[model samples]
Target: MPRLFQVIGRQEPVATVSMTVYLHATSADYAAVGDDYLLVDSRGARGGRGFYDQHATIWSRDGRLLVTTQQVVWYRVTK
Candidate 1:
């Protein structure tokens, strides 16, 4: 599986992040991609206090994006 990273926030004029994601072949005869976290417990990845923004979204590999919801608190995708 290719490595992936996800930043939780809205698209800003200035990118304030350090992460990247990779893509792999799917057996379904199609291409696909998504975000990843080093640990299931993402709060460990944050050095300081954690934060969450309802208006925030995510960017995946190939510069694709996944829409977000203000009422939604967390999002997860798996293959």
Candidate 2:
């Protein structure tokens, strides 16, 4: 998502060689009135291979699943 990019870009400056892709949304639930939610994200990078991935999930305050996302990123290696 564009918003995600904006947030990430603001937090840290990413290298020009890297790329990010939103793979898919595994689940999503509509929030009801006066409902609170939480966003949890987990990410990992492969050892200097220019490959990275991220998994993000949104959960309701009551611990119910709201949404989940899968993302993959790649970077160009230069000698």
Superpose all Cα atoms of candidate 1 onto the true structure and report the RMSD in Å to 1 decimal.
Answer: 15.0
Q: Candidates' TM-scores?
A: 0.25, 0.46
Off by over 4 Å in 2: 1-29, 33-35, 45-47, 76-79
Query: Candidate 1, residues 1-79: lDDT per residue as tens digits?
Result: 1112345333222222333333333433122432342112122222222222223344444444433223212223232
Error of 2 at 31 (Å): 3.3
Weakest ten-residue segment in model 1 by summed lDDT: 37-46
Question: For model 2, how does the per-residue alpha-carbon lDDT over 1-79 read when each residue is reduced to its tens digit?
Answer: 4233543454322243344444233434442514554656555534245545656666556666655666555544332
Which 10-residue span in candidate 2 carries the lowest summed lDDT? 10-19
Q: Evaluated with TM-score, which candidate comes out highest?
A: 2
Count of backbone collisions within predicted model 1: 0
Q: In model 1, which residue pairs have backbone atoms overlapping below 3 Å?
A: none
